[model samples]
Target chain A: MQDQLKLQRAALADFGLFAFRCDDVDELLHRATELVSEALDVPLVKVLEHWPDRGEMLIRAGVNWQPGVVGHETFGDDVRSPGGYALRCDEPVVSPDLDVENRFEMPEVLRRHGVRSMVNVVIAGEGPAYGVLEVDAQQPRGFTEDDVAFLRSYANLLAAAIERVRVHEELRRSAREQGILARELGHRVRNLLSLVRALASRTSAQGRTAEEFRTAFIDRLQALSTAESLVFESNRERTDPLVLAEEVLAPHRQEDAGSISIEGSSVDLSARQARMFGLALHELATNAAKYGALSVAGGKVSLGWDLEAQKGARKRLSMTWQESDGPEITPPQLKGFGTRLLEDVVARELNGEAKLAYRAQGLNYTLSFTVDG
Target chain B: MIDNKDGNLSGRRVLVVEDEHLIAMDVQDILEGWGCTVMGPVASAAAALELIEGDLPDAAVLDVNLNGGTSEPVAEALRNGKCPFLVMTAYNASHLFGALAGAPLLNKPVDETKLRQELSALLADTASDRCSGT
Candidate 1:
């Protein structure tokens, strides 16, 4: 018996070395059961993994079990089963005789294998119990205190190994996700650079002085920058259109407090949508201050939006920019940068349509675009 | 500030496929400045394909990523119609897969001079191919 205990200690040391270095959890669990079975001189051994979501313990790994019993078996997590009882009590449980034992229900597979006795210990980790480890013997015998001590040590090693593997996998996944996000951010940065280049080139210099050109270009860039920051500051994949409007129009709002009104329900817009819409709003406000409504006292600008349900998880957003009480407006002979941007560029970008009506009272602009919810 | 020295692309029709409005507008402006009659600067693969079916352009400029999906279908359609197209993208070469592989690639914020030169070369090559009848 002293020699047998020495052999068990050697097996435990051998398994401790293997478990710490092994990366695969499956191999670790299977090797543990095999080592314990050999050390204890038991024919049947298994590891039941606790699946909290399923509320059951799965036979994850085992040694010397029946052909179909190892991986294809499950047991209730409740205290009715021997393994469950050990897990609940946080102590080792020993059934010296199963046929005469009325404390726990006998498992069908153990009975089939003629299991007369078994010992189980909880495989516990720092967070929660991993599961239960059990060894079964064909002949009825009391499990010695030394046997329980060996099993407890083996279970503690298994739990530590399991946790190590889980943490390693989490680290690997987080690194991969960060790599993807970095690549995506790089792509977006390049795209934004391209957009700024486009805006600089498209900001026309047909009839304006260099200083005028600078102000116009800077204002447009400021609008784009404001939109980009709003999208980033929110840290959301999508941005709120009303908040976007409010932010973009804040500069124009101070001089005319009640002159500008934005009325819209909460709706989400893609980053791209918000930027373009913000630029359009800037142009509209600039035009209003220069020629249309916000130029004079008592001139009013109201931006209203409505959402209508469309087929297949899409919604249609219709926004109207109305200017009133300014000057008797006459349509300009030549289309300006703002006119072309609103009519063609903004409409095409949103996959929508925009109409500008140079009414005698004020400029009425309406645009409709699709939103993916 | 694009220099149109030769005026070679006097009447060539080039279809522009890009999702970003500013980029699309700039491309249109540049191509038109070169005297090319630019076709729809379509924002999606479906729209580009429909435009191709309607009237095949002389050549095409395709952005690899369109909104949430890739432009492989548009590339395939352009290939089937024997239409030459160059990819302008912010992504790397690996992003171009299957039908899009090995096509001419011009990185985003494309140099207007290089774009003009590449288009001229593509047209020159196609003109020679027609002459060779291969």
Candidate 2:
């Protein structure tokens, strides 16, 4: 008995080392079952993994079981099964003789294998119990306290190994995801810089003084910055178009609170869409404040949007910027940056069209775009 | 062989395929300033392909990634037409796969002078190839 205890102790130490080096949970579990069987001199030893959702303990790994037994067999998670009882009570359950034992019902797999005696101990981790490690013998025999203690120790080692591997895998996955996010952020910054360059170069300096140019460029940049902030703060793939419009027009709304009217149905827009839409709105508001309706008191600028259902789950958003009660309007003699940005740039970007009419009373601007419904 | 003259790009039709509206307009403005007749600043692959089918330009300038889709198909179509083109991207050429992997690559924000120089080289090459008629 003393020699057998020494052999079991030696097996436990060797397994501890093996578990320390092994990274794969499956290989460790299988190795654990084999080591337990060898140390106990039992014909069958199995590791049953607990599935709380299914309320079943699956035979995840085993030694000396029939070909179809391991990975295809399950034991009930209720107290009627020795593995379940041991797991529930967090203690070893020993059935010295199944022929005379009336406490627990024999599992079908054990009955098929002619297993007459068994010992079960819970394999517990730092978080929760992993499952039960069970050793079965064909002959009717008793399992001593020493055997139970050794088996418990072996189970503990296996649980620690499983947890370590799980944590390692999780860390690796997060690191990979972080790398992707960093690369994506870099790409976005580059695109933004390119966009700023485009804006600067395209903002014609033909007529405006240096001060005027600076103000116009800064205002446009501020509009873009506002759009970006809104897109990020929403923390979603799409942002509310109405909220975006209100936010972009917030600065100009202070002087003539009732003059600028913005009404729109709830709609979601992508980051790019919101940016382009916001820039166009900024241009319209700037133009209105300078030469159109918002330039004088009692002038009015009403912006309204309507959604029209289109074919194949698509929706068309039609927005009208109607200005009134200001100085009489006349078409510009030459096409400027503002006109090109509204009619050409914004339209092409949104895959839509923008029409501006310099009417006698006011400037009427209409924008129409298609979006996924 | 190859002419790097100022008026060489004049009357040449160049198609521009880019998803970003501002960038697209900027490219159009630059190419138009060079006296090249810009066919498009199309945003998507389908639109670019449609334009290609309707009429092939003298050459093309394509962005590698168009919105969510790659410009590989458009590059393939341009290749079949034997039209010379250059690629502009926010990424490295190694990141590009298939046909875009080997095409002339320019990173954004593209240098206006370099863009002109590269287009001149491509146009010069094509012009020389036509004269040789081999």
Candidate 3:
């Protein structure tokens, strides 16, 4: 009697340390299986959950069981197995002689897996049974009442640990979803503010005259807004220069009637360059429509670009906007806001150079810049 | 602002679908001044659908984008109803609504004279067709 008391005290102390040391669900289950098998001196210890929907017992964790049969084995719909009966009734079930108990029938599945005698303790959390913790032996080894009671206490602690881990995983998933939503909202707000800025700039440039300027300003702002929408839809960190050029030129493309040609290799530009380039293209297209190529019948505008490698391992992009076949060309006496915007403002903001050359036939503008790597 | 040169649509009903309140009101005024009975200035696709179901208009002026790029359903319904509608958009008309390939397009903020001219032409065509049927 004294030896049995000592054994019970030792088993209880081991189970207390094992439960406290577990950090997560998998760790807790692993340690519980090890502790139970070692304390009861049984060859196999398993924690099986009764899936009521499936009417099956699933071995969630196991120790010292058959090499491959631990998690893969399942006992279906049979209340005969010790685990199923213990989980259903929320009781500790012990079979001293499996051949004797009429209601306690041994499942052939468990018997084939070398489980002879077993004690199943129902693992309960707050209200009902969560699963079953079982200790099994290859031979007909009888379990004392003290062993069953100790296992029942440990089973409750394991169930609580499992619930804590599940809550932690849910919190992590919620945090990730919230982060994604916040990022998308910020991106949309930034794009809207940029649109407003472009509108203000275009309106300010069209002179102080109310009706005439408003008409021209709205036309230009609409063009910029279209380009901005395309950039946002692409979801690119840096806009592709070739794509920006195509979007700005789309409204002016006419098949075999009037030509607006583009020639260059594809290059990716930063957002600043993309926006400034879009503004410059809008200015060029407007000029073409009013006094240059596109204004006359059968007139054409050619836009071309090339990337030159610099000595310091940098690439300089050179672009030219040219117009042909229009009315007699003459330089304006005073520089308009369009000229100042294209020549000084856009060039300075983008860290580039712009030159406007008034040729005999049409207007020619060149822009050059070294982009960052 | 409504140029009723042919004077065909002096009593026909017209619907205006625009998200911007000022723009919608301007369009309504233009259509009403043309002697056409105007239905709405509805802001969203849902509201437009509700208005149409309540009283189907003879024609509509639709903004290609509202809330986002989701005005295609409204366009489809109008087409199914066999209503000759015009699209008013700030976007590049070809790029945004290319699928409605041969439909009439008017860019916004609309020019007053151009808006009057186009609306008159479209309404006159619709009125003549109805007269021929009768």
Candidate 4:
């Protein structure tokens, strides 16, 4: 009895150190069953996890058991097994004999292995009992109450280790997600700073007077800011060309949707293309409202597009804008910010050409660009 | 502040390669104000290269991201033409052109006075490089 007590003490100490070194739960459980087998001088030791939904306990890890018994085996939690009794009582169960056991029947596999005695301890976990840890012997023998107590402590250590690994994995996943979000924020801020710097210098040059400069700069900045808000809020890298036109013309068409018309096939513009075209549409709408069709009571603007061609992997889109019933129009004296933006920046951004004209009747515009379909 | 031997930037052709029109126009305005003749304000590297073959200018200004990519090909053409050029870019990085290491760099929203000074230095360097036969 004294020797058995000393052996059990050493087993608990060794397992306590083992738990600290285990990298994962599977390794912890497998090593634990091996430790139980060595410390108790038993032939069979197994850890079975509860699967209440399946109404069974599965052999998660074991020692001195057949290859088919570990991992690929399960047994019911009915009243016949020691594991079942432990779970039903939520405590340890000791069955020193199977030959004359009246309450539980001996399983064929255990009977085949000449097992006549068994002791099981419940493995306590977060919300419920995780499973049972059992030791088997071929001969019926005395199983002290102290031995059941020792097994219960070992099972507790296993549950704690599993929970530790799960929490670690969760933390690491959340940290990685935060890192990606921070990088995207930094990239956007840098781009915006560069954009404003370029805008200020160019807009100031367009101003002949300080007042003219303020008006042009403020209007341009407002347009860029609004477009940026719409693009980011959509949370999509590409924007629909038709939606862009409607949004840029929203203020002009307020309570007068009939004054402006938009028609186009479904086309998604790339991020760079979207920003450039969004700004272009803003300028066009602003011009029409100030001097073209949208300026007069009877004038109206119509925008339209068509798929010009689809060559294998590339698609070309052609668009047009015209004003009708506006007062007589004439070409501007010189190229201003609007004219330069339409004919130069917009054309360059789309890798296409833009034709802008001021006929006696109205302003006529045509543009075309190609994109991957 | 090196003066054009002719006492004016007039008659000295300046090639301009920039993707953004308004910014390009700013550069064109500055060059024209200095009395220099502005060549193509071409918006792409390919177009800039074509212009270089037709008539290489005395100097050029380039943007790093032309059509969303580096303008190294146009830089190469400018180098081969023995035409001095400086980059005015929004990007602050060395990888813009790893091979074009020694060329001058100017930042976006260019300080007009500094742009002219850098252009003079680049032009002078190109002239000396030719005189030395490198």
Stretches off by above 4 angstroms in model 3 are A1-177, A180-188, A191-195, A205-214, A254-257, A310-314, B1-134
lDDT of 4 at A203: 67
Docking band of candidate 1: medium
In order, what is each prediction's RMSD in angstroms? 3.8, 2.8, 19.6, 6.6
Write down the lDDT that model 1 would get: 0.87
Q: Which TM-score value belongs to model 4? A: 0.67
Each model's lDDT comes to: 0.87, 0.87, 0.70, 0.77
Candidate 2 lands at a TM-score of 0.91
Per-model DockQ against the true two-chain complex: 0.74, 0.73, 0.01, 0.24
| Docking quality category of candidate 4 according to DockQ thresholds | acceptable
Residues A1-373 of candidate 3 have per-residue lDDT tens digits of: 5666566567667756765655577677877888777777777888886677888888878887667766777776357667777776668888766657666667765677677688888877555566788888877867777777777777777777776666677888899999877866664454445344434443444346777777667766766565566566766746666788777777777544346888876766765567678878888888777778777777777888889887665678899988887766777787765676679656765667999888976889999887653
In candidate 3 the C-alpha lDDT for residue A292 amounts to: 80
Each candidate's fnat, in order? Answer: 0.91, 0.84, 0.00, 0.25
Tens-digit lDDT string for candidate 1 (B65-105): 88887789988877877778899999989889978998999
Worst window of 10 by summed lDDT in candidate 1 chain B:
B125-134
- Encode model 2's per-residue lDDT on A1-373: one tens digit a residue: 9988988998899888998888888888899988888889998999999988899999999999999989999989988887888888888888889898776788888999999999998988766688999999999988999998898888888888889888988999999999999988878887888898898988878889999999999889988888888887886857777888888888889976898998999887877888888999999999998998888899999999999999987899999999999988788889898998899888888889899999876999999999786
Tens digits of lDDT, candidate 1, A272-321: 88888998899999899999888899999999999999998789999999
For every model in order, the TM-score on chain A comes to 0.88, 0.95, 0.56, 0.74
